[model samples]
Target: MRVIVDHPGWTPASEPRRTVRTENSAWTATAGATLILNRVGEGRDQAPAVDTYSPMDLGGSIPENLRSALEEQGPVQRLRTADLWEALATAIIRQVIRADQARLMYHRFCDAHGAPLPEAGPSAFPRPETVLALDEDDFAGLGMAFKRRPLIAAAGAFIESGTKWAELPADVLVEEVQAVPRIGPWTAGATLADVTGDFSLYPYGDMAVRKWAAHASPDIDWPTDEGTFARWWRSFAATPEQLSALTVLTLALGGPRGQDQPPS
Candidate 1:
């Protein structure tokens, strides 16, 4: 299915791709969109294609819970693009190694493989097989953990099965991804952000985000529960239109090129 992401200002004039997780958190995340979203089953080539997206289906509708206050904070700013599988590799490497180390490893890995890095906000995440086939000892030489070898391999295998990482149902992908070696909720969440364009996840593993939460409330600490974070996200929107608006805002505020804070 072609997925055309619906956001206020962001438009996917470019192809969809995986988004990179950077030390620059302020960057807006771009969602991968396709024609499937606009399909009415009659055929997309037809004039004025199928339209209308429901909140329940998108997981981005307005919030009506006690978290109504969440909307007052701001919208989720995001870019109009994503880098697909490439983002997954970077996210995994980040989890396995320090940011600096991960970046170095990624560059080196890309260089050796001839996938020179892109200057854009994001690029396609490498398939798991490509990374898994690498020499683990090489990363070890960079002081990265050796334990990640299995995780990387697992990711490669997962992608090999025509697994649509970005488009899979969240529950299924989350469960499956967390099962991979060294992968957990955070890693899976990042993968989803790049692949599916589902923005409900706040990418909870960032230390910088944790610190932001700590500062938000003394009672709240890093690694806060999903329930709490969800509630916080709820406030980012008040209506379906508002939710879309926040998606744009959240990405913009997060530092589209500078530093990105966790969705407020």
Candidate 2:
């Protein structure tokens, strides 16, 4: 059996296992077994919470075509990022780029500025302080000059009220994160969804979502504009939970790994 970890910054480690590190913990996951989490250095113990949701949860709410596609893709788990900074940073990096491009940039940014976890073979995202301390040359060198302002602004905002933001509900969190200068609706929505496991907070009109939805059900006429498509997407689900499930399942159907294999 093979298991793949879909979380950003995670990397494969030997057969059937993957590993990642955060500020407080180092984590290892083996196929068909519980996640093994250990303290990174030492400062209280922390572990990531894995939230699993099934496509079946949406039931009759989804269209026959979408439902069929999801069932074929199978169930997916939402592993919330242990660090809010990491989530925010990821969203900032992903803005206005293809998934493959964003992924390469993310890995590059981490390797350049983040602390290395040698044993695990992946680096942890740089802290807010580290981001603030960086000069323009540093960002430009990493090919992240475009993201410099947003990253710095987010770091400052996170330093001031990350704890409070973390406590806010998914909807509120999305709204709150937008206060930073360059952190717009789409970025905030993506960040909130990543940390909270509430895909209802995702920017439903995102190109990826729209693209995959159209790909999944070629017969359905999905809207082209962001606003109209967002409303059209909402009309399918009677409840927020259903909306989350529908959007997530649709994304999973044509995720980065491709259309056939769902994220585990």
Using lDDT, give the best candidate's number: 2
List the candidate 1 regions with Cα displacement exceeding 4 Å.
1-84, 96-101, 116-127, 164-167, 204-230, 235-254, 257-264
Give Cα distance to truth, residue 86, candidate 1, Å.
2.1
Worst 10 residues of 2 by lDDT: 255-264
Q: Please provide, for model 2 over 1-264, each residue's C-alpha lDDT reduced to its tens digit, 9 standing for 90 to 100.
A: 112244445443342333444555766544343344444555554566665656666746566787788787766664567678888888888777666666678778878988776465556678899999999999999888998998999899999998898788777777888888888888888787777777888888877678888887789888888889899888888887878877777776664232221111
| RMSD in order of candidates | 10.2, 4.1
**Candidate 2 clash total?**
0
- Provide the overall lDDT of each model, using Cα atoms, as 2-decimal numbers: 0.43, 0.71
* Candidate 1 lDDT by residue in tens digits, 83-105: 33454455565563444445456
Q: How well does candidate 2 match the true structure in TM-score terms?
A: 0.85
Task: Give per-residue lDDT, candidate 1, residue 118.
Answer: 37
